[model samples]
Target: MWEAPEAPPRLTVSALTAQIRRQLEGEFREVIVEGELSNFVAHTSGHWYFTLKDAQSQIRCACWKGTNYRIRFRPRNGQQVVCRGKVTVYAPKGEYQLTVEAMAPVGVGEQQLAFEQLKAKLAAEGLLAPERKRPLPLVPRRIGIVTSPTGAAIQDILNVLRRRNDGVSVLLYPAQVEGAEAAASVAAGIRWFSENPDPDFPVDVLIVGRGGGSAEALWAFNTEEVARAIADSTIPVISAVGHEIDFTIADFVADLRAPTPSAAAEMVTARRADLLAEVGSMASALTKVMHIRLLRERQALETLARHPVFDDTQARLRDALQTCDELTLAVQSAVQNRLRFAGWRLERAGNRLRHYPWRPYLQLHEQRVSELTAKLIAGVQAQAAVAQHRLAQALTRLNTLSPLRVLARGYALVQHPDGRLIRTTEDAVPGQDIVIRLSDGRLLGRVAQVLPEPEAKPDPPPHS
Candidate 1:
């Protein structure tokens, strides 16, 4: 009945879209949607586009790189996920879509899913093999630690190390142990220790850990960056992250795993007293071996001296004497080599124990090493002197058995013209030519006397 209603206000396509966008954004400013993910696409611009659908309907969603970076897990097609976002209309497409701010797995935490995924991936790469692990140094001169400088973990480690008073030089690399940047920081610390070892005191091992904390707080150690850092470290790494029950990827990839930071510190340092005792035992054993060898050499020389064959065979005696000299030289060389090797080992141990800000025990160690060296040298010298003296006496005894000395004592050797010895009166005829060899000179003459000898008288029986 009224005049035709004024034409409804016409809207441009852009205007319509703007109006719809406003209503949708206002109404769905924040929402959480759960569905099966499909048509997933990660754009070159670092944005993610996907469809979330159920049996009945579907909705398009976009996760900008800025927002998706906060998501712990990677989104994949056909996965059931929960997305939180706002709804807005696209002006060009005339469609409403979700601008996803965050996302997670439908039933599990994103962090847990990510952890599992990384674990499986690394396991497949053989990084989790027990054979990949390396043994820690028996004694570490410098220990490189990665953790929060202000945290209880550092304090706990320091307390443990101090309690033992192992005199291990510790180099701390301050890093965030929690939060998003923690993984990067920890990895950087590990890599720094690996690439840039100290010129004077290189890091012997690395300790990567933190104080016990909640799962969220300890997740940095669970990340790929930190795990890879531990795996690739040139230095042996001990992963001491969280309490005994809390495990991280770093724990699996590290060369050794400790349950806590304090425990890690304890594990790294061998007791100085125990190591010194071991060194002492080794030295004592070596000394015993050397003494036994010298005794054997003396026994051999004594046996050779007592043998009657040495008195008759001058060549054999000379050979025996030469052998004795050789043996003596060999024994001397062997002792020196053993002592040198032992000294090398001790010096190496001392270097490891020689921590920075030199501890008092270091001086004591130096003294002990010097004393041991002197003792070894003195013992070797004493043994050598005894051997030389014995050898000289043996040579003197051999000299008394010399034929020249017998010849000098009014004895002479008669020889035939052909240089054969004249032993009996039957062989030495009156006309045979003979030579008389004396200590001073030789005489050539005809054999003029080969007389027969008279019978000698027999001895009487002993009186009862």
Candidate 2:
């Protein structure tokens, strides 16, 4: 024999799958596939399975949970996206597909596209309606802030608040301001204020914002989730993301929007602050109003005072004063004439008295006084005797029923310290203080004994 029998080389399914996997992997190590997404299925395991198809051709693509979950913008069905990932053949299926390391929408700037898409979606749901907006509190009692704990946003807000002497309570809910998790974190902060509201530090308004940054840095605010959170907040929300020139989807859904984080603080307190700052102007305005009102009221009163009715009443009062003056003069003349006539009569009477009435009248008056005095003595004696008889009779009747009379007849009244009369021995308690009232005075004594009444001897067994 010249050579050993040659063995046939037949490849197994595993070997063929392996060869295809290596060959496809080498050919498309790093790939950028641009196509419209279709049949997208986000598996429960967080893996995204979809078809990248165009008008002419189509290819299968898979975004692993590990790689694709990092993408910020959500990939939708029929959305034109550029997927960048390594092309690898799935060993089991022997099909080649993009791994989808990253993805972005086509035609528009990536950030702008995401922003517009979310804006439209939210607008359709009425989250962007003016009716959904809430007015800033006239005087916010508490203001909740959602931003990075150490970021410049919080510092700016605090500085502004300090400058204005913002009396409203501030509660800072620290969350990442710029990152993949920033949107969810911001949403969580809104929900925290909306749900776990503290009665002591109750959040009346929310300021969700960050300092100025690039569009990508503030992209978290454009997220649909964060927008929905702002829309659904029970408390009024103020969106203050980026600078004045930059706008986000959050600004559309929030109850209010500020150009910057510091501006948000000023806005929350602006109603009260503006009024306080222009206190002089307001005072002037009020003074003007009061002056106008006073002028109007004064004119009305002056018009009333000038009425002919009042003038007629005043004329009548003047007439009364004139009549009173005339009467006064007439009374004075009449009094003077009466005094002169009385003086003449008194002079005539005095002359008569000097000539008449001497010792006879005095003697007669003295005799009459003596007679009346004797009569008065007799009447006084009779009244005294009648009063004395009635008094004796009243005393006799009172003595019969009086407790003092009973006590004087050798009876004693026992009374408890509380002033209750003790009727029997059972009413007395040993060692308790009591009072015994005799005829003259009350004697305080300690109760020595309380003897119980003896029981009858069973009534002699009461007849069988």
Candidate 3:
């Protein structure tokens, strides 16, 4: 065939633009592009428009508010990110763009962004207030640990606690400390320990979190639910989330932040050797203080012994002799006065004794007392006899009123087998077992038969 001029493809301007747009959209759909964000603009109409670029190439991207809201952190122009989105074209301008569905910071990952977001939020809510923090118990009776049962974190904490203070008991609330369900499981464990505290196994402090890991591995602690659970916990929570340098949301919300699990255990325990050393130091200081006080007291006694009055022995003896002489003279004067008064008293007593008739009076009083005593004894004996008779009568009446006496009089008490009193025939079913109690014995019986009394017939009415 002869070479012919190529026919120009014929299309209207609108159709051409549409065709190009369809081609671009088909080629760029569902792409994951890695680049630094730039020219970022979040519109009032709830759409994000940005440009993603590396050193070599650039592409326009758009994320609707619905998807943007799901992202954990703000997307800034300088942030390097990997975005997953579908390509679409602005038909009017025929410009190709990406409709981003999800995005994450390239090096930091979504988990890290989530952690920072949660940390910031809880910090703003004052969950991490310094005043809200509680001191770790000096010696926790039981420490509750929430972590992976098989993890090194638990082992490390156990080792530290055991070495520091073996007296404290550790109660494990084994939970997944990483992965998708970690937050919920940790919160559940905290709640369980709180609600069902054991009497003998009560937990005084809670140690929560795992060993050091990547941001994704430690994301469970970043969850708001986990943070709030730690904040709301009644028992003090010591957050041991990661290595010494790592920090998580739980660390801020917790009552105390431990750099590592081992450190948290140390915070809760006291070393035996350290305590003994402190005691020894205090004892030594106390002994020194006592020795100094005793020495000072002895010196004061010696100083008093060396005083002028104690040193002048002969003068002191002479003063004592003079005082004795004065006391003897005073004693003699007092004795002479007392003797004179006694003589006068004895004379008066003798005259009174001679003038009185005490013997006759004493005989008369003795006779009266003897007569009254006889009357009192007779009255008391008579009253006692009357009381005894009344008491005998009361005893007889009480005996007559006794239930045992009624049973002895041939009256039996009927009761259901269950011990309820059976007062009427209706109380016993035809085949029901019953107990009959007599004065000295009980009989268990079953109803063999029941017969009702015949109804009385009414007399015939008078003849009308």
RMSD of each: 16.6, 37.9, 38.7
- Candidate 2 wrongly placed segments (more than 4 Å): 1-106, 274-286, 289-464
TM-score of 3: 0.45
Q: Write the per-residue lDDT of candidate 1 for residues 313-422, one digit (tens) a residue.
A: 56665676677678767866876787678678867766655656555776677787778777877877787677667766876787787777888998988998787887
Off by over 4 Å in 3: 1-112, 271-278, 308-464
RMSD in Å for model 3: 38.7
Clash totals for all candidate models: 0, 0, 0
Give the lowest summed-lDDT range of ten residues in model 1.
Answer: 308-317
Q: Model 3, range 343-376, lDDT digits (tens) per residue?
A: 4543443443332333454346446545644554
Whole-model lDDT, model 2 = 0.73
Q: Let me know the TM-score candidate 2 reaches against the reference structure.
A: 0.43
Highest TM-score, which number? Answer: 1
The better-scoring model by TM-score among 1 and 3 is 1
Task: Give me the displacement of residue 157 in model 2, in angstroms.
Answer: 0.9
Which of the numbered candidates is closest to the native, going by highest lDDT? Answer: 1
Determine the backbone clash count of candidate 3: 0
TM-score-based ranking, best first? 1, 3, 2
Give the local distance difference test score of model 1.
Answer: 0.82
